[model samples]
Target: MPVTDVITDPENLTLTIHADFAAPVERVWAAYSDPRQLERFWGPPGWPATFTAFDHTVGGLAQYRLTGPRGEKSSGRWEFTRIEAPTLFEVLDSFVDDAGQPMEGFPAMRMTLEFSPTAEGTRMVGTSHFDSAEALEQVVAMGVIEGTKMAMSQLDTVLQDLRAYAQGKGTRLELLDDTHVRITRLVEGPRELVWRAHNEPELIRQWMLGPDGWEMTECVAAVAVGDTYRNSWAPVGDTPGQAFGFEGEALIIDAPRRAVTTERMQGTDGPTTLNDLNLYEEDGATLVTVLIEYPDLATRDMILATGMVDGMEASFRRLEAAVLV
Candidate 1:
């Protein structure tokens, strides 16, 4: 986690956060000024931010929304007030409606973010100035401190190149909590091709096979919301494994960008898992992120103990070798 200290001063009507990163000042500044990188860690876990508009000039504005796990949304805006390249910037932040209008009862805050070179790397200081003590206390009580900590912790991942950070790591899993786990893989391919490899049956059959000696017997991909998808696999001759499949309905689809689905094992009445898949492309490589919501800790452990990650890693390697190349 990059955040080292958080201070809330009611008398000063301010909340300040201090963070240290092992990245240079220019790199740290770029992460905040670039909308694509900013959205990667702008919101806390389970709630991801999407920036609709980003204008980084002194008088420009940025608009974004944080989408919750269940499709709920909270919109906000930032009016840039000052900029000093890789050193400092300031913005007027406020809650906004979907139409880009400021919310009625919410007050805006002036946020100043400063970056400085340190011996190790870069040090950041973020201060939010509120209109009154009441406003400062209001946001603090709403879990701003904890949310900011979680959000900033994700910056380390963004500060490094996706391929450098995740390629050799294969399919990695991070248990976000009792019910949520984040899985990631980096593939050397365009985002469009990666999306096609997942949705097109021909491409899927070429790479979705988990391990050697296994064949994908059936693949019915879901292309839109409410569409159902099923995929089955069987071991090849002399291979020792049982035949099984998974069935799911797509809950959301933003072709070549993101997809969310509910997955359950075929012929089972057990709890289902919500799989949210997101693909991001930088240069020619795509980072595939899947945020899964399990029912409970027991279910999460049981699924992971089934050698699921190993199978996923094998399939991803094949994806690059067979489908991507």
Candidate 2:
């Protein structure tokens, strides 16, 4: 579901796919470099892949076999043509015989993988180039597009596990009172950097995004007492006039220590909620505590039922990577 676009261009003999992950570029790159991680999501659903041999350096080779549900197996190999750490790589992908030889008359494609940091998270752009339009169409007819989509969808689970491992522990959520909720996490970074990432508009846009395919289109923060902060977000692709955002006013601002704000959701007449953010350095890392006070218990329950906790956990994981790593 994180895959936003899949384009097949016959004129250029290329098949391109765009996927977004709620993790840093380094983590995303590791999913490809590490054979154990690569085997987790390298094949389509119901067809798990096992890597027989893997060497991730330039001119190196990788061999894998995907086993279908009905005891069927398909072998493949990748000849690494180029390697650029944490950003880009190129490979010659082809079908191989049981003896590890390239299959004759099968269409071999050149693949380029690109990883870049975006406003929300890391964007992976994969382009596969065939020798000719006929060859490209041949692969497309063989269900390559759908297979790729299903395979990439599995990355979300892999990324989530990687994030939890990197953060040391999962986020903690508690109901403080009938109308209050508290969330806390130990982030791997300095207090000042964590504070800057939350207060600065430019840094906020990079990690505050709630989910994949959504971006903060507008962010204006006035980080002083009585100043107002306004932000907006919408889908990143092709959907116009559909937006959800909020505006808030600063009530208390203590740089690198604490901040209090009153936030009102856009297009809603509900009572404004109070948000308190406190930061501290503990054992060379930062501890971020957020307390939310709703107008009533119903409002708090509604927010909790909306899965905001999961979304916030995803956002904070990105924040940890952007600020510290």
> Which candidate leads the pack in lDDT?
1
- Which residue segments of model 1 deviate by more than 4 Å? none
**TM-score for each candidate, following the candidate numbering:** 0.94, 0.51
- Candidates in order have lDDT scores of 0.91, 0.82
In the range 110-209, model 1's lDDT, one tens digit per residue, is 9999999999999999999999988888888889899999899889989998877887777888988899899999999999999999999999999999
For model 1, the run of ten residues with the poorest summed lDDT: 66-75
Task: Go through the candidates in order and give the clash count of each.
Answer: 0, 0
lDDT tens digits, residues 1-325, model 2? 7789999999898999999988899989998888767766798754557799998889999999876533467889999999999899999999999988999988999999999999888999999999999899889988988888878876875666433433566577778568867677778888999999998988999898876677898898967888998889888887544787888888777687767788888767757888877675645677676778888998889888977888788888888776578
